[model samples]
Target: MAISAPLNTALRAFAMLLFVVAIAACSRTPNAMPTGVGNLGPGGGAPGSQQEFLVSVGDRVFFETDSSNLTPTAMATLDKQAAWLNQYSNYRIMIEGHADERGTREYNIALGARRASIVVNYLTSKGVNGQRITSQSFGKERPVAICNDISCWSQNRRAVTVVQ
Candidate 1:
């Protein structure tokens, strides 16, 4: 027996729908944020992924223009990060400092390093082990937003926490 053209199209569409459903079903909890403490709790998977860390504990802290100092807002966010770090002692974090596109490459690198160091010091003061944290500067090399305006530059001047 030969299938009709319309039946063949319908079957193909049905198979595609089934594939999509299977993928959706395989997904874990939609609202589940990575606790930063490996999935050793319930799920049998590798340690919490960086994406999860970004979702659960804020991964980036913004800074003012041309400054390495932490603002009150930044400090608040870091406080939360420090608490999370303390709770998940098994995880080590690398803080990355980034600058906007306004300075010479060498200057920007030094500035970025200063920004990252500030964060490390802050976290250390909050009781997070200094040994568990390290910092690097990407300077203006990596930017989250690209534009000549302060608005865009503001987005790029930041310190990001990465789990290792």
Candidate 2:
């Protein structure tokens, strides 16, 4: 026997309502941020998260022009980074070295490599495991600032630490 049209229509409407409710139940609220597996510790990020490292400590260190040597300021930043890495032992890091636009491509690559290596050495010396850190040289390929002046060049000459 066939159901009446009105009854059938009501049933379909009820099914649609249930489907919508189910979907809504599974979805997160608009303002809810996605969190990691464990508790959120300091710096407003989950423990060992990139957000934690960046927000609590710093992710980048600046260098002098044509220099791979870490300045006192850069060393200070590295000290913080090393401490963070030691605390967050589960995370691995990549050090990306960059250079100003004034150097030739080959020269810049070498400079950048030196810069990255120096950062890696510093971190390792500070008790961060050497195996957890890797380095790459971007040369003049990536620049946070672009201009023909010291201001921009200073910003470009740096190494950035990325957590993974």
Candidate 3:
């Protein structure tokens, strides 16, 4: 087969374009997660790494319908948070309690308070100082997920730990 000059020129241009793209891709570092910025693995790391707390310690824990009791899963998450808090002893935190929109304002506020208290107690038990923590109830006023469905309601019923 004989190759024409114009066809050879086009093939050479296409090959050059592909080589440039490959070089560009290799030079760029992926932003999957910042290096050494987040907790490397589950359970155990020094605090002050905001990325670690948000990604590993998990700032929020969910609860059952109309209940403030901590489930095993919730406890595990709280345990990790407590560990983080203990490591970062100088930091103070606020536990923000929230509720689904299924109850009256007053009722929800009370419920939220209870939930927040439970979280504080658990964290204290896990070696975090009670003095370093405070609690507030948002009731149904603030919700991370807003919808009438169970999925959204479940998300709204949570206690969030805000480190300050």
TM-score list, all predictions: 0.70, 0.73, 0.74
- Tens-digit per-residue lDDT, 19-137, candidate 3: 99999998766753444433353333343666668866799999999999999999999998988788888788999999999989999999999999999999999999999999999
Q: Which candidate comes out best when scored by lDDT? A: 2
Ten contiguous residues with the weakest lDDT in model 2: 33-42
Q: What ranges in model 3 sit over 4 Å off? A: 1-47
Tens-digit per-residue lDDT, 1-164, candidate 2: 99999999999999999999999987855645455323464455765677878877789999988899899999999999998889889898999999999979999999999999999999999999999989999999999999999999999999999999
lDDT of 2: 0.90
List the candidate 2 regions with Cα displacement exceeding 4 Å: 1-44
Q: How much is 17 displaced in model 1, in angstroms? A: 20
| Model 1 bad stretches (over 4 Å) | 1-52
RMSD (CA, angstroms), candidate 1: 5.5
All-Cα superposition RMSD per candidate: 5.5, 9.0, 6.3
Candidate 1's residue-wise lDDT over 1-164, tens digit each? 99999999999999999999999988767656554344433323333544545665588899998999999999998998888788779889999999999989999999999999999999999999999999999999999999989999999999999888
- The candidates, ranked best first by lDDT, are 2, 3, 1
Cand. 1 Cα-lDDT? 0.87
Best by TM-score: 3
Cα-based lDDT at residue 27, candidate 2 = 82
